[model samples]
Target: MRDAGESPLLVAADTFRAAAIEQLETWASRLDIPIVSGRPDGDPAAVVFDAINAANARGNSTVIADTAGRLHTKGHLMDELGKIVRVTGRAREGAPDEVLLVLDGTAGQNAIQQARQFTKDANVTGLVITKLDGTAKGGAVFAIVHELGLPVKYLGVGEKADDLVPMDARAFVDALLPRAA
Candidate 1:
């Protein structure tokens, strides 16, 4: 977002997995970005609420909240995601303008299943396919988009923060199926 001239404040709302906060904090520090985090094992929704309030007070243009990475098959985790969404709405009306679901490019058919469940549960607005730097072609992107009718807003080409680039349909197609020399 900083690259796009928007002041972004990150919220570490993934309080479940160990080291999740530290990971986000590391990126925030490396990028010299502002962040809002809660105590360990604290309420993720509360953290998001606080982040939204902080963004408002600080005049930040965007608040990107990172929630726990939950498996779509897990009913309880899915419920928690719904709670976070509701809390986010309460924090600021018409908020969470975009809900993106990140998927492993190598996840093939399983990615479709996961996308189905995630979109059904979270109203996922777009997708981000990661691990494409490897042998993973991310062909499932086509199926997922066709099935859900959601655009893929970004592609994670590498591990670095700047590795996430905007999706260019032509470029992606060329990379996936290169033309003869």
Candidate 2:
């Protein structure tokens, strides 16, 4: 979101985890971005609604909602994610222009399964592979694209916000399979 040069409002919609909200708040502060959060353990959809209103009122061009993470096996939690998407669209047409599913690069084949479920449940438009700077080759990226046919939008290389880089196929492949020394 920072790469777009648009003032983004971080919406802490991960009401299930206080640490998630705190983490988002920390990132917001570090990035000097505004944040909208609901009461502790409040409904995530309500927080999204409030965040959308705040973004419109504050004239923020983008609103990045940090939703709660749940296992793909959890049907109820997945349903809640769908609710969030619906609420977002109702709040503003075409609101979530991009629904990115953040996957752990280290998750390997497990990531593929997660993507499949998220794509179906949350209407995932793209992927954000995180922890790519580690030993994880992120080979599951190929499996995800091949099976789900969704594009990899971003890569979280490190802890810093700037470490989030755009997906470069050539670079990613080269990094994943380096030539013998």
**Which candidate leads in TM-score?**
1
Best by lDDT: 1
* C-alpha positional error of residue 130 in candidate 2 after TM-score superposition, expressed in Å: 0.8
Please, what is the TM-score per model? 0.96, 0.95
Question: What is the Å distance of residue 143 in model 2 from its true position?
Answer: 1.4
Candidate 2: worst 10 consecutive residues by lDDT?
A: 1-10
Each model's C-alpha lDDT? 0.91, 0.90
When summed lDDT is taken over every stretch of 10 residues in candidate 1, the lowest stretch is 79-88
**How far does residue 35 in candidate 1 sit from its true spot (Å)?**
0.5
Stretches of candidate 1 off by over 4 Å are none
Error of 1 at 60 (Å): 0.8
Q: After superposition, how far is residue 180 of candidate 1 from its true place, in Å?
A: 3.1
Q: Clash number for every model?
A: 0, 0
